[model samples]
Target: MEMLTLECPYCGVQADETELHAGGEAHLTRFGPGSSDADFEAYLFMRENPKGVHFERWRHVNGCGKWFHAARCTMTLEVFGTYPAQTAEPPKKIRDAITAKRPGWTWRELS
Candidate 1:
């Protein structure tokens, strides 16, 4: 799939489609022992296909080579913001933007 121009948050480089690689969903915690099959399936395959706020991972393959998280709207394909992949959750600004755009929407705290 063709990717759009992505700006690297770490190095401040605007990477073209060819310079970046799309990673799958971010912030996934691996299921361990004592977990049921359904739970494992949810972690490995079942993903959120929401029409509103979504978060994804991107790698600046040909530029900074750092992984970052991008928050975007699935319906509009509008990018809200991006940040380092090491973060545990979406930044406050991104959350605020999404909340403003999608009134009454609240982010669920992942267990």
Candidate 2:
């Protein structure tokens, strides 16, 4: 397995994989109480495991102890950028970086 060195979007510190924790996929809708069983199941288990570009949640445990989203390539382990966790979508800069590297990539209808 390869290691990833990502920059903490909050603290601006570059940390290796050992200093951070992987929090699975980012930008997922949460299903709380009163939601259907299927919706809750999907929320708990369903996730995108693509072979190429991917976005994921990462916590800067050793640095600022804050969570952020990272855009990277699953196949090549190339990190495009990292952004604040609170962002609703990937920022324009990150998207542009992915575009420059990927050419024709799209995630959940955002191209």
Candidate 3:
């Protein structure tokens, strides 16, 4: 039997890939007509290419279908914490949880 461990980016649970789902990139906010080329570049390409801690958007496509932000370290492929997406501000628990699990990881709330 073959299995891969996956983290649920919404509920902060670690389970087999069978129990979780993969969603694409996070923090994709659209720009207005007056935006500059640099702004477009920043939006399209110059975003975080982090090696260690990174914030990504994912969905529990199999479980709840809710979007979430995953605090992950790409170098180690470790998911320290996950929180609900579309949050106006990261809840204290989410911030604390990420800090406790992966220090120096920043979680930005996306609208």
Candidate 4:
């Protein structure tokens, strides 16, 4: 495993992996009290572990102390870009970067 570095979207600081905490996959649908047990279980545990491009949540624990989203490649560990956590989807710039590196790549039908 190589050392991972990510830029904090809020603070614009390039931070090493030690300064950040991974928060698992991003853009998950939350299932609450009224939801079925299976839905809740899937919400909590199920995740897409793709071999290629992946979107993930990361917290800049030692920088801005804020969460952000990162589009990266699982196989090569190449980060496409990072964006604010509040965004509902990957920004066009990030998506373009990924597509430039990997043509025909799609993220949950957002290709």
Provide TM-scores for the models. Answer: 0.80, 0.91, 0.62, 0.90
Candidate 2 Cα misplacement greater than 4 A, ranges: none
Model 1: colliding residue pairs: none
Q: Write the per-residue lDDT of candidate 1 for residues 5-87, one digit (tens) a residue.
A: 66689998877768888887777777878899988988889777677777889999887789998877767667777889888
Score each candidate by Cα lDDT.
0.77, 0.91, 0.63, 0.92
Question: Model 3's lDDT to the true fold?
Answer: 0.63
User: Can you write out model 4's per-residue Cα lDDT over 1-111, one digit (the tens) per residue?
Assistant: 698889899999999999999999998989999999999999999888889999999999988899999999998889999999998788899998999999999767578
The residue-by-residue lDDT of candidate 2 on 1-111, one tens digit each, is 788899998988989999999999888989989999999999999888889889999999888899999999998999999999988789999999999999999776667
Give Cα distance to truth, residue 58, candidate 1, Å. Answer: 0.9
Cα displacement (Å) at residue 19, model 2:
0.5
Q: By lDDT, highest first, what's the ranking?
A: 4, 2, 1, 3
Name the lDDT value of residue 63 in candidate 3.
71
Tens-place lDDT digits, model 3, residues 1-109:
5454556645556656566555545656666578998787766775666676666666666676676766666777766566678664456775676678666665344
